[model samples]
Target: MGDAHVDSEVRFEVQGRLGVIVLDRPRVINALSHEMVNRIHAQLVAWADDDAIERVALTGAGERGLCAGGDVVVLYEDATSGDGSETASFLADEYRLDAYIARYPKPYVSLMDGIVLGGGVGLSAHAAHRLVTERSRVGMPETQIGFVTDVGGTWLLGRAPGELGVHAGLTGTLLGPGEAIALGFADVLVPSQRLPELLERLETEDVASVLGALAEAAPDAPLLDERPWIDAVYDADDIAVILERLDELDSDAARDAATALRGRSPSALAVTLRAIRIARGFERLEDALAQEYRVCRRLHAAPDFAEGVRAQVVDKDKTPRWHPATVAELDPAWLDGVFEVGDDELRFDIGPGTSGIITGEHDDGDEGARE
Candidate 1:
């Protein structure tokens, strides 16, 4: 184990047979910076080859949760800067990291305790053991900021049962622990207070045995009851038809969901829906991530991305004036542009031993935590 400061910058330690990763940015709820991602990637690559490390455990430094997501302020800067080199590098490396996690061979346990957000989801959701606490708040609220979900959001969210994934994407909804489990985002629930004891046990006990001893029963998910309506309304591929369907529902849940959808950037809604739909057919995490890269590249230059960031992050006004403010006004060609990967398209350098991935990041300061 290292000193407190050393641990804060993403400390990697071999505690007995366990490989421990502590995300140490408590001040910003353990947001993923570029440097932190690099450190994590380097260590993870090393650990994959080390026979002494029997299992891996990831957790945040503070009580706030695992991670907020990638650095959005940096993303905002990159988006508006005209030069997209930084943004491109971040997305490519981040996506590769996500793919590596999906394909990692060992026992990977993620303690998704608090606010596991967008970038945070990339870190935890693909683990062999994804644990959530009652205090956990998870989602991809990128739509509100005029960005579609990235970090393999389409792959994960698209695979959700029924139309729950589409609803989650369109509304930028944050799911609590129960909802998360119901949505298949988490594999187990362990009370936050018991996490330290679980970590202590991981030093000697296997991940499954420790979880079986400490995990609690998850509460019922209220969203499950609304699935009928969620499915009916969100099934439409066209955003306008989807909204129209929502408007027709007699249930208050439908009305509320409609209102939430209306408040988001129209372009983001359309693009997110398309991305999720496309992801439904993807055979690999890397494929979905590559598509997300194409979309993120196009979105960077789009007016709405910068404006959405300004309203939500910079001004804190929460009032973005989306061009093509309504779904009906959105040009199909513009939406199609997101799928066209340029010469600089992302490609994962995956391998048997090396898994070929790097670190991913999202901003902790943003309103939405990653799902």
Candidate 2:
């Protein structure tokens, strides 16, 4: 590989003519920092204006991640003093970047190699071309962290194959390459070793061409494909029914999923599932994002999110006390505020509505990595 490079708090480089961005902090599994967010935004905008740049590739700096998600330690710390005010600010800007990448102009590629979860899911999932490797391990996982899946996941999850979105949101389970692709969370899957060679080729090849080439060499199936589950259950509109089918998996995979779901906040799961359903058939991305913002504001204003994070991450208690513990106890009115935006609440200014800024970026070039 040519190894053309740029380094800062994170990293921005070029492989031949391709713009390559690496999430540089490896210590906490490449947890995203605010500075990295600002830099990535700046670099991407700069790249957008450069005529010489044909494509861009985004990756992580360490062995374990394309990115694990946002800095949980930071989130936990921010909420420690009974001030969830900071949490709102972090999410607002983070979602803005997620929207930015989703709408970026050039070929934006995400090499989802390993540990792609939560906010990590946001950074990559919306890209036009997502490449997963044999080592790829992806998930939404925000339910476990006391947050609903932010970073535009509510919209994506709302639309995943069949009932898969509800399944993922409720359980916070991990999805391997095949499962990710099957769920429509990823587009292509290449082997781990061929990555560097592929990046070199990306400088000259368009996305369609690299996919054509990679397809000839790669296998047909994902590592842990979820076609069976998706076909049988993912399409079900009802969340409770999905659980019944999952209980019938009769395999280790199903058992693992069931166990993970048992530990999550049921109220969060229920609200999340409904939010996804309402978000469906949405004509624009902002419509969906605004809906998510409503849910988040309620999360902080209420007791679940902050307290959930407290017990699970901050206090390390592993025993979150979820009020209205059952789905049946939840009220539809809880989300009305989210849908009906207020003066202090967050709202996106997507095209045809406000700034007409780009919100859905498609990766036209096989820029870096594909799922």
Candidate that would win on TM-score: 1
Expressed as tens digits, the lDDT of each residue in 202-307 for candidate 2 is 8888877887677423334442365577557645655556667778887776777766765666656655766778877776555666667767666655666767
Task: Kindly list the per-residue Cα lDDT of model 1 for residues 51-130, writing each as its tens digit.
Answer: 88778889988878889888788888988774978888877777777777766667788899889888999888877788
Candidate 1 stretches with Cα past 4 Å from truth are: 1-8, 357-371
**Residue pairs in collision within model 1:** 69-362, 70-361, 70-362, 70-363, 71-362, 71-363, 117-369, 117-370, 118-370
lDDT of 1 at 240: 90
For candidate 1, what is the TM-score? 0.93
Deviation in angstroms for 102 in model 2? 2.1
